[model samples]
Target: MSDIIVFGIDFTSAPSARKPIRVAAGVRQGAVTRLNGLMALPSLDAFSDWLAQPGPWVAGFDLPFGLPRELVEHLGWPTDYAALMAHYAALSRAEIRDLFAAFCDARPAGGKFAHRACDGPAGASPSMKWVNPPVAWMLHAGVPRLIAAGVHLASLLPGDESRVALEAYPGLLARELIARRSYKSDTKAAQTPERLIARKDIVDALEQGRTRLGLRLKLSHAQRDELVADASGDSLDAVLAMLQAAWAASRPRYGWPDAVDPLEGWIASA
Candidate 1:
């Protein structure tokens, strides 16, 4: 059997005191084993510590690593990976807000930012965009750590096959199965019993490997209950993202390739 550890990462937009990063792990033996607990790391440093643990592992992180090539060219930001990370990290939220605001201010109300071609295909939020989801900053906050961790980015085409990283969008998988139904809810107030049931329904389907994608989730009963209990879905979301990562890891060709085109994106469907 291949030794594999999968990490599912649920990313944050503006990581505040309330919402930190949530990560879940799934170990694969002859079968998949969903670990008992999830890890909630407070800061990037803590996350780095977790990543540095001794092991060959694959991670599915739910954040954009690259922006649209068009957006980068228009902004005239450094295209090199190292330079881009530095440039992005140096800017504060306020600065990012101002820049995006200016861009929006200049454009007509209908079209604020120029979206990449991949955006339609991938159903991805614009990497240069800064509003609603603030995915650009999610990339800003999330990607640097992956780079620092030295994991093999699917897009980078790195030679090291042990430490694999893939760009996973859990919503894509969720929408495929559930369609328009709301299966997972992150809002505290919206987390009613009905939503909890929905989460369970989704989990049951995943365990049974009922989707078009032929992957089964091996989870313990206790783990399932815990996943459904957490209204925030920090753990469940991470697991979903991790599963996507695992799916990507299994396939070399589909792994996010290093390319510039924000328009090329994927999204979850109902």
Candidate 2:
């Protein structure tokens, strides 16, 4: 395997050893990418420490790296990507909630969010949402760590060349393989056989190289079984993100569009 590594992060804001950030790590070898390991960062602090380590690696993190441009401009936060993140990093979560709530209240009912161009295609949640996926919190909890670690966030900002971060959304890939099909649930009571079958279908398609990105997933028998058995789909999402990381590694500009807004970064494989 090459010294260069790849990672996919399934993040949690309130992390612990019991429910830490799930990471899928792997290496790309020619046409096949082998998923070599799965691990966790027990807390956000632990996650930060890991990012600070020196390495030549590319990672696809399942979190929004920026906010809506309109929102930023409206709030008069820094328009520069790095400056905006710095400003965002300094805010308390409660302050974020209050500010974003007022912004939404000023907008029409059906159009509460100011979206980046990629969101519609990527089918991602608004980075400002505080509930459900809580991606705003994901941005709050995750991006600052990336910035603090001094890693290059591909199109967003330049930092360490070896340690590159790209935003990834596994749901984008999963939906391509199985449209609008629910594959996994965080709640044990909600994990159904239908989702299980959908997960299997997605796995089968990836192995067959059926997706547009055109990279085959290589997994051991046990790894395959373990991914398939996770009712929460966290493991599967990590793998999907790993595949996106693999794709990003193989492309120019990390597969981002040529004209992405600097303040509103692009999502990998969106």
Residue-wise lDDT of candidate 2 within 1-270, one digit each (tens)? Answer: 343478888888888876778899998876677899998888999999889877688899989999999899999988999889899999999999999999999999999988888899899988888888788988998999999889998878899998999999999999999999999987888899999999899999998889998888888889888888998888889889888988888788888888888888888888
Q: Which stretches of candidate 2 lie over 4 Å from their true place?
A: 1-4
Model 1 segments beyond 4 Å from truth?
Answer: 13-18, 29-36, 157-161, 254-270
Lowest lDDT 10-mer window, candidate 2? 1-10
lDDT of 1 by residue, 1-270 (tens): 574677888888556557778888877544454553577777777777776665577777777766665555667888765676678788887887787677768889878776755566556667777766678888777777777777666544353457776676776676666765676565767888877777787788889887655668888788888888887767777888877766665554544444533333332211
Per-model lDDT:
0.68, 0.88
Question: How far is 257's C-alpha from truth in model 1 (Å)?
Answer: 6.8
